[model samples]
Target: GRKGDEFAYSHVVARAFDTDHHQLRISSARLHDALQGAVAAMSEPMVSHDAVAFYLLSEEVSRHVKVVQSGQGADEVFAGYHWYPPLAGVDGDDAGATLDAYAGAFFDRAHGGVCDLLAPEWRLDHDASRALVAEHLSRPGAGTAVDRALRLDTQVMLVDDPVKRVDNMTMAWGLEARVPFLDHELVELAAACPPELKLASGGKGVLKEAARRIIPAEVIDRPKGYFPVPALSHLQGAELDLVADALHDPAAKERGLFAAGAVEALLRAPNDALTPLGGNTCWQLGLLELWLQAQGVR
Candidate 1:
């Protein structure tokens, strides 16, 4: 009933009839019907870009109600963006200039075009910045630069990036989420693909070529778009207050998920505070508090 009358009726009927019927029967039916209607409304190539349709088809065969997949790694692997191609093409001064351009673009986006947003106290001092940047941009445990890039990405961004988001969202609905693309085999295969093959001729060239073999060429060729979510934009008022509350809550503090001083420093710091304490620590603290509360861990 919380989602309204239609959802309540569907819930009751689903519960009264059969549990599987509610989840698979009603939900799948509605999803399929809506997708069909959407496809019909669009043009030939547009209909082919139906990732939802492909997902639903997989779901039907596997009887899995929920799935989460990330499409970012391939893009990263194959220099898919406008920036990466130019960076890769340059050498000597041109390469240095390209890196500067990339850094400028990142600063503009991350700092809202105001360099002053990064507080002087928290800003990376020259030596520290150089070391940090070197460490971050260097490829560890790989022979080639490309290999190192893949290893670093797989270790940090691909593996760790989506864990909390996927877990929290799926668990909220009491649904099991499967990530087929994250299968060990797929990860290894992606890592092993040659950089020249992966990044050939600009964009995620290899992935696009592979997709053409199975998917319609039109779908494969289309410019990629990010999956849309309004969560960050909508976090305000009660939501922002809830975050503040959780950070300062005595129970949360007692749980010792994060050092109290660290949490305080993050809150007290400016929005663009470059302090090491100001990154994912707040969310990590909040999730840890929720986990403690759920498990009665005190």
Candidate 2:
């Protein structure tokens, strides 16, 4: 729990289990200080926003524990994302439709939008992201559109993004994390379960039902909560300054990854310019520049 930003429902479960619970609260200043360290820890750049929270949380957790179990692969293995439902009744053989649906729901921005953001020289001639998705979808074993989407997410996106974020952040503090849902046997079982079963109860239905037996209904039935980090989400004060600095730096201008006009527009309205996925676009762009500079890539 992170003080004012805590999910009240989590506290309910803690009380029910009578588990030793500890909470960590972070200030905007402390979070800003940890940002560079979080970026440095990652093997590659990620714009997942919650990475800093994981970094700070892991630092605190290491004081008490060496290794901890995390629920990392549950969503991918169990089909818990909002994108799963529309693909539910889609024809198994319609690979194009499946790729379109998945791209519509998950890609941060469309290819045209990405082209607009990048310098002309940096823009790709084709939808490389879609090509990547299509390659994964064509792979053997997955039976239906939803199955392909699940397989793609579980095998590709989850490994690179959330799992990597957790690994990098946790290991930064000498803390080891075990993702039980990713155990080979469990993943295989989850992969084999009918998509309909996993998509029920508003997604992850099977897991929710199983959880009902042990945990309180409130925790199981409530809306999925992403770890909150408000300071980064709606940047202001020193946090906003940090992002502005990175995007405007000499190295960023020399590299010219983003179009000058696009970068300027984001700086003008940092809070308003968001990606289709609701990410702060300024932060995403700035973080890339920051990470590159940190790595001495320039």
Top candidate on lDDT is 2
Global Cα RMSD, each model: 13.0, 1.8
Encode model 1's per-residue lDDT on 112-172: one tens digit a residue: 2122323344344354433433465553345444454455455654544343344433444
* lDDT of candidate 2 over 1-298, digit per residue (tens): 2233554876997899998877777887799899989999988988888899999999999999999999998989898988889898777688888888888888888899889899999999999988999888877778888899998998789999999999999999999999999999999888889999999998998988888889899888887778777776787888889999998889989999997699889888888977887788888888889899889898
**Count of backbone clashes for each model?**
0, 0
TM-score of 1: 0.46
Using all chains and alpha carbons, the TM-scores for the candidates as numbered come to 0.46, 0.96
Q: Clashing pairs in model 1?
A: none
**Candidate 1 segments whose C-alpha is farther than 4 A from its true place:** 1-72, 77-83, 90-115, 118-133, 139-146, 230-298
Worst 10 residues of 1 by lDDT: 40-49
Q: What is the C-alpha local distance difference test score of candidate 2? A: 0.87
